[model samples]
Target: MKKQNIYILAIESSCDDTSAAVMCNDTTLSNVVATQKIHEEYGGVVPELASRAHQQNIVPVIHQALTKAKIDKNQLSAIAFTRGPGLMGSLLVGTSFAKSLALGLGIPLIEVNHMQAHILAHFIREEGFDRPDFPFLALTISGGHTQIVLVRNYFDMEILGETLDDAVGEAFDKTAKIIGLPYPGGPLVDKLALKGNPQAYPFPKPKVKGLNFSFSGLKTSILYFIQRETAANPNFIEQNREDICASIQYTIVEILMDKLKKAVKQTGIKRVAIGGGVSANSGIRIALKNTESQLGWTTYIPKFEYCTDNAAMIGIVGYLKFREGKFTDQSVTAKARYIIP
Candidate 1:
């Protein structure tokens, strides 16, 4: 018998970006993301504003995705959405829409964990991207999370270590703000760091024990350092913007690599993969690449589009769950703090 094609519509509104994607099995046919520029002025995402924007963008975004995929809603086999580990209001928006859409289309509803979607994003079919085998280590670094996860199967994952306070992406943004960068400054820091010297300003790494991570202290130290320097020369940030960004990126990348090395040593796993927004950082990418040559570790990094919050990641997870007949009923609701089970 010939295999049947599965079409999945995925929704993601865990934060400021509202996105939708249409996936044919593991391959993404269309992925549409609507980023909220409103949060740029606030120097961070505002929950209320984010949720409201989702309400406005969800329908149009989903429509665009289906249109781009050249598929009709009636062809969808399941509706998948981010269920939690994010802003409650944002989660609710995606959850309610997904439920209603699934009901209307008489299709199954699949709930995807936002963080897990980041990891499973590696599974999304694409040219020039190789999927990691089971029993590999996954480093998930995003604005809201920093975790080292052990992946044994599609649904089987264990978090080996995580952040105690601020996530690594948060650390990057906080440091950028200390130096008078704009909101959503993480990418800007990465951009500027590329042109600067990583060793120009040595920042202290946090002294966290075990495989866990901490960035709160590092962010505070950066703030104080900038303050002291600016007190003497008000143009310090302007004069040393590139160098400061490079140093900060270097320190953050070092922290992540240190824990990843420890995880590799403890678990004896050499296949490493990275996901989430911070994984897009060039410094971290370079460090991971260096490991492939220096440490004999094979690293997996997703495309840039898959790095940030996107529904294509959710769609890939939905496709996986659909294959196993794992579906949720109408009683399912959004969870703000849903963890991997």
Candidate 2:
């Protein structure tokens, strides 16, 4: 007998991006993301604006996802959505929509943790991509979070270490802002860094004990350094844009790899996988690639589309949970600080 196909509709609105996706088991059929350009004017996300955008984008985004997937609502076995660890108002938009849709369709409702979805994104079946085996290390770096997770199973995960203050992506964007870059400057910084020297200017790394990380000190130092330089040379940023970006990227990547090396030594896990928006950085990608040859470790990097905030990652998690009969009731609500379980 042929196995039954499971179709899942997933939604993710943890922050500025409102996304929807359809998945058939572990394979993504269609992933649609509506990024809010309005936040670009503010140099950062405004919670009120983000939530309002989600409300406007949710219906159309879901419609497009289903249309692209060529599947009707009746064909969906379940609806999955991000439940938390993001802006409260943003989470509510996705949560309420998923709940109402599931009830209307008389299907199961599954809630996915945003961070876990980032890690599990590696498992999404793709033509050229390979999934990591059980018992591996996952470095999750995004605008709102930075965590070193120990993944022993699909749902079994433990955060070995995380940011004490600012996340790595926040550090990147904040640094970019200081240099007069536009909002959503993280990618711009990465693009410019490629043409510059990584050691052009050295920045201090935080001395956080154990596997935990800190970036507030580094961000402050960058601020002061830029302020001091531009005071003498008003055109300092313009004259040394690439070099400055390269140095910043180098320092941040070092901090992440140092802790990751420590985590590897402590746990004796040689396989490393990375996820989240900041994982899309060229510097971080290069650093992880070097470890494969120099340190004799295996590294897994997801496709670029899965790197940033998208519903495809959420759909993959939903598919996994659906397989395990991990459905939630209508009583489920959005959580702003949900941890990996």
Question: Clash number for every model?
Answer: 0, 0
Q: Estimate each model's TM-score.
A: 0.99, 0.99
Per-residue accuracy of model 1 over 266-292 as CA lDDT, tens digit each: 999999999999998989999999989
TM for candidate 2 is 0.99
Every model's Cα RMSD, please? 0.8, 0.7
lDDT of 2 by residue, 22-67 (tens): 9999999999999999999999999999999999999999999999
The TM-score that candidate 1 achieves is: 0.99
Error of 1 at 273 (Å): 0.4
